[model samples]
Target: MTAELILKLAGGVPAAFAACLGFGIVFNLRGKTLVFASIGGALGWLVYLLASGFAGDLQRYLLATVAITIYAEIMARVQKTPVTAYLVVSLLPLVPGGGIYYTMRYFVSGDTGMFIETGLHTLAIAGALAAGILPVSSLVRLYGQFKKHRLAVN
Candidate 1:
């Protein structure tokens, strides 16, 4: 890989590590919990890259959502806390804040064409992420239900 790519990867790693660590500490994670969260974040980034490689921007976002959601669910199970806490950090990278900002800037400047384009792009990204996560969330719920059913039968 080129130096730029290496730098980008490195930048992502530390940001993810710090985000995960912060989330873990805030949520009272102990022992190996911090390590796990950091690992999850790193792995999530890798998943994002892999998914992005095989698809377009929207599909990439969707794949990232699926990866992050799975990571959050697994972390919740391990940490014995709600998934929201970890998810908050896990989704830091995927947010469309920059897109929204640019869109608004273009709108304020009366650049209707650019504004519309940016807005549409932002919505498409959001839609892809939502679409990707919905299935994972549904699967998790279904798995939980199956576990419950098994327990009830026994």
Candidate 2:
């Protein structure tokens, strides 16, 4: 809400967007699909920043992943594309790149204590991200099934 926060978000969002855009390109997404994928990443980062104040890192990543996954699902349906196309790019912003790096760094540096701690932290964050996506995707699948059953009945 403050100007400082707004500026920070402005700076971060474009980085998130670019990260998604870059990954989308790597994954062979093009045109409008790539744009939407970038938007998803930016939106997820915004959500993470907003929720970070209220929760720890794991919780923040979980919240952001859930939001982006839902957005990706909706976009996929509207665009008649696979959800993975969008979800994969969107998740770029939320991935624990730093955690993974630090975990490896600690291990290579021969710091067993830090390595174990960082490794566990990275795993927990990764799990949280997965936990966020599973429920929403399942619900979407369930809704599709119910719809199919209803239409079949008709």
Candidate 3:
């Protein structure tokens, strides 16, 4: 996209990294696991930014989630650890916390329109995140099973 978009996304990368790193530390992730999980957050944000150039917010989130899930799966496989640890930490940047806050704010202020709008948007984000995770995770499991079956046959 434009240089402005690139610059903004670039700026966001470090923030995403820092946020994930903080959460990873809180989750008791240490050493390389923590570092790679943080990097996965940065990578997810970068993918979201790049996808934002051509996609709607939901699409961007979906694509970014896909990217992060793939990264988490790969990293988990390489590190021989559970994928949930990396996936959860890496997805912190995209969790739509602000949407939920504003939805609540609107509800409290008696603004039904904004409340409904923001609430729906927030729900959509949660749905998109779940939808994004499902396919990648299922495929990974299926692939693992297939490989195992092949190994057993041989």
Q: Go through the candidates in order and give the clash count of each.
A: 0, 0, 0
| lDDT, model 2, position 97 | 89
Q: Candidate 1 on 1-154: residue-level lDDT in tens?
A: 5676577678877777777778778767666656666676666676666664467877777777788888879888977877766566566567687999999999999999999999999988878777867888899999999999999999
Q: Tell me each candidate's TM-score.
A: 0.80, 0.94, 0.94
State the lDDT of candidate 3 residue by residue for 1-154, as single tens digits: 7999878877899999999999999999989999999999999999998887689989999999999999999999999999998999999999999999999999999999999999999999999999999999999999999999999999
Off by over 4 Å in 3: none
**TM-score ranking, best first:** 3, 2, 1
lDDT (CA) per prediction: 0.76, 0.92, 0.94
How far is each candidate from the true structure, as Cα RMSD in Å? 3.0, 1.3, 1.2
For model 3 the local lDDT of residue 41 reads 96
Q: What's the residue-level lDDT of 35 in candidate 2?
A: 99
Angstrom error at residue 15, model 2: 1.2
RMSD of 3: 1.2
